[model samples]
Target: MTTTRAHGEAARDDGRSAGRPSGRMLASYAAGSVGTGAFSTLPGLVLAYYLTDSIGVAAAVATVLVLVPKVIDVLAYPLIGALSDRASHRTGYRTG
Candidate 1:
């Protein structure tokens, strides 16, 4: 004979994926994204100000300095994503 269990009892059988992300995970992702954005933008903002005013560099040059690095950073994103996928697979987690 087979027995059936309620939803709560079934959830207790497996430790993962009872539902969507918890509040803690959502908060952590939000904070981490903000931190990373600050780290990336702070230097560019300072340099743009210094180059256009204190250093007497042209606005074009300042823009180039600010934008080129960002462009390069964008280009690397896909490769980094692929590398992360490979690492996950190596660690025995499927991308699916």
Candidate 2:
């Protein structure tokens, strides 16, 4: 059960090559996730607060206004990505 290693990849007794990410990658990924989470979250929070405080919109109404599009996006994006991938495969263009 020997595994071939890619060039410049360090081999390990654990059977994973350096091509597999290590702790640095995990830290980088964690940082990126935190940044993405904050990036995605702040706009909705600000919009909702603005609607309630500045626009005189009711809090419940503002909450729903802010929430529904996110709900729709959550529901629709997977189907859209699947369709996009299917179209790209049919056209034989991986990057499309």
Candidate 3:
């Protein structure tokens, strides 16, 4: 014989009690995204201009300076992904 459970009971059986985010959690996540997006994007947009115009750096040099960090980020991401995968395998949690 088969038995059926309510929606909440079925979610709890799999250990994810809070199946969907609460309103407060969703609001907090939205606020965090706005703040983090502004902080991350503003510098990339302004840094090269500031270096070339205000600091009197040559345009080519400023471009290279701005680009080097991006290159490092490209290289580092794969390594970080691999590390996270390994950690997840060991701990059963996908956290670095």
Query: Which one wins on lDDT?
Result: 2
User: Model 2 has how many clashing residue pairs?
Assistant: 0
Each model's lDDT comes to 0.82, 0.84, 0.78
lDDT at 33, model 1: 100
TM-score list, all predictions = 0.68, 0.58, 0.59
Q: Model 1, range 4-67, lDDT digits (tens) per residue?
A: 4765343243334655666787899899999999998999999999999999999999999899
- Which of 2 and 3 is the better model by lDDT? 2
Q: Report the number of the highest-TM-score candidate.
A: 1
Q: List candidate 1 stretches off by more than 4 Å.
A: 1-23, 93-96
- Cα shift from native, residue 39, model 3 (Å): 2.0
**Which residue window of length 10 is worst by lDDT in model 2?**
10-19
List candidate 2 segments past 4 Å from native: 1-34, 93-96
